[model samples]
Target: MDSRRSPLGRAALLLVALVALPAAAQGKKPKEGAYVPAPADQIPGYSAKVMPCEIIEELIPPRVNCEGELLEGKSLRELAILRNTIFARYGWAGFRKPWLRDHFQKQPWFKPNPKFTYKLLSDADRKNVHFIGVREQSFTERELRRMEDTIFARAGKVWNDVYEWKLKDGRTVRSCAEPQDPLDEKEGCTGANCEGTHSRDCFFREEKWYRPDPKFSEDKLSAEDRIDLGLISRSLGSFASDTGKLEKGAQASLDRVISVQELRQLSLRDLRLLRNTLYARRGRPFKSKILQAHFKAMSWYRQDPNYTDARLTENDKRNIALIRSVEDEFGGPLKDEDWLIDPATDAA
Candidate 1:
């Protein structure tokens, strides 16, 4: 018997040839999916190879529940990407806003499927979506702008500040200033932190996501966003109470060193009290009637006729100066004399 010419020998050689053909032709082992990229002519009017939709999810690593430290420092945009990309992976396209459809479509691997639907999301997908949604509530935009703002803020788009406080009278104000008409209005800074602008130094700046448009208006948000905003307002019943207080509830300023990062979370209105709070701690007389009234309300505030900066702790001075500097940067230099007044003196 000649083993070289055996039927088994021929079949074994054929199997080896089949296994090695692909790798040999490509000069590398096939990837996990062995996905074939479309050629220049493979996709209409394209001159370069494009990846198939099957591998788009591979661009970003999948998370396990997207929990804890995984989400810790992630920016609002990053979270949106993590959550929405799951939908994009299944060809969900964009929300009614259309702000993001081009984003996923621009990806070489993206190939939209008409059959995509929310029902297609897996249990794991729903969990990640819910997790990101809950974590998103902590951000100022989400808290102030409601759910739809989450999508807009991530794209670095600026809309008129929808969050406004209604006065006892018919007047309305936003960011402590009168609300401007959305039509025929100029874009400018509103809050102490320029909450209205999309400057690189804005809060979203940390994540390099802010791309504000001076002309962009809240009217630009989708009808769906407006509808959702209305439903949210109705559900909550009323916003007569300023939401800002909830953010600043008893936050410490004089006790420890404060960082700019921590300050970034605060509204400018909060920073105003934070700096003044430092002075109030030493029983320093506040000339500003508002400041005086605020200190009077605090149980800890004991006005000392002889209070002086000299009585302040080293930490207090540093914290005060830091808070003042940050405030001035956001809200032009407001002289201390503007807020603190000299105590009255009398001849003996």
Candidate 2:
């Protein structure tokens, strides 16, 4: 006789069915915290046991553990996503924050390893990581701004006391100083050797020297100024590519005058200064047409494609007219006097 068909067995079977059915289906509601895990394969990985979500601390090239052993291949970004997914699926919320922080601090992408870091990445890893974090929405705007400021501060410190000199041999040398003689005191002039052929003067007297003004320390520079200084330092070589024709000090002077914001605000005098500096560097006339073309190509200029004399302010119109007049003259090489002569006076 089938036990399930008996009255007592039937009652037990009914009780089991009632308990197993979802309460809502039985005309009642299920309580909260009744989550059930989906199948392991339903998670992102092919096999959850061998998911690509492990990080080895202090590795030269970052390694991940997809299975039993740590292996190198995936990027830190890829590993981060895998770890985030694993933590979310496994309900390891508590581990995610600390794990992300530690990973960000130590990862080769965030901080370069002495041996394993790429040459291109050595100086730019922080910026690269910050950009990635911003793109991934991992960092807030305020957090990114703070990081940017910190980077600027560190860079400013590096350029603070730096100085550059152009030797008579047409080579440039840069160094950091702290109110000390560029040469050692042991090399100082003695009366006996001061006029001698082997004197210290023999080495330095012929070479040109350049140094930061003793009064103008890095701390005295505005934040914008420091940023400008850093940019010039990085781009100095590129700017001085035509140094063969450039007069002494032209590159350094141009460095002081050039900046994105200041370019838009350049007065006629400023433009003249820039043109003269370029002329001195190129050993050729710096034409007004070239200056106008350069100005038109600036980001500020391109921001308004419909730019015309009608749109220009009175001062701007005057500046434009002055530059154009100089270009129209097509006289021999331009001289400093050419800029000093007012266009209005010539028109009259």
Candidate 3:
């Protein structure tokens, strides 16, 4: 039943009036009381019938449910800075501000670095910055093992769904190698029709030919695949939180250290996504960092999987390997050359 309305129905009248009011009459601005609706027809060539109806959720505040003391939560100021910086760097706009703020500020280990001053760099100072201090949460042996298991389980599904099928025709046209038949035509052994008994002495047994199916090649994971992947990732995140092993709750705010060689092995698209994400975290422009990340990831791939970088999981190694075949073919990574924009000299 509509609790917003009182028994007298006066509240219902007030609510309807509030909803029907224009933006100018709302009288409240963001951070004050309520979010006013932005006009839908403000865009160029806008039409009411052709345009989609969008609900502005910010107008309604979220209901807060507290289990016990609100003070029991973790501080996440550092995580907020990281998250904000990433979005700003990537030129991405219109993210859910409240969600971003809440996610970052809720992490167990996120604390404000008051000593650090936030700096917005111009075209200059692109490459001079070195050695950004990134803090990663420490996971206990149990937590690490759990994460490893979760990653393996998730990747296993992807591998099976994407690439698990036996060739139908067998190896090659091989004849009967049974001692009873030897190399006779009566023994269901023919060079063209039977398993290649004729090539018993061949280096590789290619006698059994396999007929590859185009339908099998056409099969692919769809949107459900990503949903399943996200479920596994979220489960892993939950495990991290349960074990007190998270510096931040926001997915983009994690300061994970992945090797260059490791990045090289992921699918090219995935590698680019990761690289873009990392670039956003750095508060720097994306240049040749993709190439650098890919190269470094490959270098790491050549070594043992146990190498500790906090970022390289066994699953990442496998994923990267699948994507490493694609070439970057882009310009070399960003340069440190500073082109000074003189205030006095204006020649445009």
Best-fitting candidate, measured by lDDT? 1
Candidate 1 residues 195-255, lDDT tens each? Answer: 5443322334345556666666555655445434432321121111111211122324235
Error of 2 at 35 (Å): 81
Q: How close is candidate 3 to the true structure, as a TM-score?
A: 0.18
Per-prediction TM-score? 0.26, 0.18, 0.18
Question: lDDT values of the candidates?
Answer: 0.43, 0.31, 0.27
Model 2: residues with Cα > 4 Å off, grouped in runs: 1-216, 221-260, 285-338, 341-348
**Superior by TM-score: candidate 1 or candidate 3:** 1
Q: Tens digit of lDDT per residue, candidate 2, span 132-238?
A: 22222222223333343333343332223234433345444443222223332324323222243232222222335522233543454454333333322212211
Candidate ranking under TM-score, highest first, comes to: 1, 3, 2
Q: Which stretches of candidate 1 lie over 4 Å from their true place?
A: 1-253, 333-348
Per residue, candidate 3 scores C-alpha lDDT tens digits across 224-298 of: 333233322322222112111223344432344444443332222233344333323333332453223322322
Candidate 1 residue pairs in clash (backbone atoms < 3 Å): 287-341
- Model 3 poorest ten-residue lDDT run: 339-348
